[model samples]
Target: MKTELRVAAYAVCVRDGEILLARWVDREGRKRWTLPGGGMDHGEEPVATVVREVEEETGYVTEPTVLLGIDSIRRNWLRRLAGPGDWQGLRILYEARIVGGTLRNETGGSTDLAAWHPLDSVTSLDRVELVDIGVQLWRDRPPLGRSRLTDPANG
Candidate 1:
């Protein structure tokens, strides 16, 4: 099987009971609420990637204040173009604070909308698993930076 590895960074920006999120358009053309972050560019630090991605997706200037955690997953899938392959994803999660910029949706990007959702309603939304992980990390703050309460099925 072909193998691939992806490393991405994400931010969990919560303030006054609201969490900032971006609506990501997946390969299947379905939209899912996710953190305001994405894959890292070549030679870019994960910190830099999170800052840049948050600005691009949510139009918010952010500073990652705390290292929330890292989530790693592996899956096997049949891709339409790349055929069957094993994919590994390393997702770095950070606790970020909005320092500047106004809220706006990203244009010509993987995500279409950016909005703030009340923390209590997040679980009811159509969101990716990363959202849960990020929130859990922010709440529990495990020393190892992992969420023990996250659903295994979601990963």
Candidate 2:
């Protein structure tokens, strides 16, 4: 089987009582809430990737204030268009602050909508596991730069 690796950056932006989120549209057209970030471009630093991705997905110019954690996952992509393979994802999480721009949905992107949701109600939304991981990392601030909670979906 082929082996593929993907490195991405995500931001956990919390203000007052809300957390910024983007709606990710998957291959099946199912929409799920996710952190405001995406994959890093070639030769781009993870910090730049997070900054750019937040702006692209949420219409907010952000500055990463702290490196929260890194979440890694591996899965078997049996139906991958590029052929069956083992895929590993390295997700870098950061605590970011919005510096400028207004709240607006992205156009012609992987994510279609962006909004702030009450932190208390985040678990009720249909969201990716990364959302939980990001929040946990932010809230706990584990010294190892990793979340204490394991992703059940990945296991």
lDDT of each: 0.95, 0.94
Predicted candidate 2 versus true structure: per-residue lDDT over 59-143, tens digit per residue: 8999999999999999997864777899999999999999999999999999999999999999999999999999999999989
Error of 1 at 47 (Å): 0.5
Output the lDDT of residue 13, model 1: 100
Q: Which whole-number lDDT from 0 to 100 does residue 83 have in model 2?
A: 78
- Shift in Å, residue 109, candidate 1: 0.7
Model 1 misplaced stretches (Cα beyond 4 Å): 150-155
